[model samples]
Target: MNITLLEAELRRDEGTKYSPYIDSTGNQTIGVGRNMKANPIPKDWTFPLTDAQVNQLLAEDIQTACASLDRFLPWATAR
Candidate 1:
């Protein structure tokens, strides 16, 4: 339940490129960027990202990838 760890995972997966902003009300907005600069914010959106939203997104990702760990370090666990 660490925010830093979740942020690290989000950063690793390029969360900034996807649902960048955590929104003012704990909601995620996708494809909010426009232009070569790859703006990470939406026009109608407001500032301030809540810890809940950011953590939620990262947590969901971690959950989805949980099964992928089985394939990792397989040789060591193989019997």
Candidate 2:
């Protein structure tokens, strides 16, 4: 899979963000609208992530998404 393309699409669709914010449904979200419920932060995690941290979070989210896709569509790995 083209992770660069996937990241581009995610940024285009979800919109990149550096600071933590409450989403429409009131979930604490950050780094391209990553839902805290689905991707929990460390117990000591803080708000207002730096640019590097935001990028790291986006990378982690991308990995998680890819894993999910692989699990649901095993044939994707054969491509």
Candidate 3:
């Protein structure tokens, strides 16, 4: 997963149905329904990064994710 290609976004999802929650000690049940929609990513993001630069950024982002996810990846796959 390229970090550059992927932007960190906080998405608000709307709940389908009402869900009741039991508080600690079972004093009272609370119903919380409907989740707010996730905000869209900011547009007009400027960058000096090119496609190549973005790819590199993504590879770097995954360095800790799986150890060697980027090791086999290059600009093009060798036959």
Specify the highest-TM-score model's number.
Answer: 2
Model 2 per-residue lDDT tens digits across residues 6-69: 7888889888777677988989888887897878766676767777777888899878877887
Which regions of candidate 3 are displaced past 4 Å? 1-46, 68-79
The digit string of per-residue lDDT tens for model 3 on 9-78 reads 2111211122233344543221112111222112442343345444333344345334543455553332
Candidates sorted by TM-score, best first: 2, 1, 3
Clashing pairs in 1: none
Q: Which of 2 and 3 is the better model by lDDT?
A: 2
* Pairs that collide, model 2: none
lDDT of 1 at 78: 50
Report model 3's TM-score to 2 decimal places. 0.25
lDDT of 3 at 38: 24
* Runs with alpha carbons beyond 4 Å of true place in candidate 1: 1-9, 12-49, 71-79
Cα TM-score of candidate 1: 0.33
Residue 23's lDDT in candidate 2: 85
lDDT of 1 by residue, 1-79 (tens): 4546756765665444343445545554543221213323335543444555445445555654454554775553355
lDDT values, one for every candidate: 0.46, 0.81, 0.31
Return the lDDT, model 3, position 3. 40
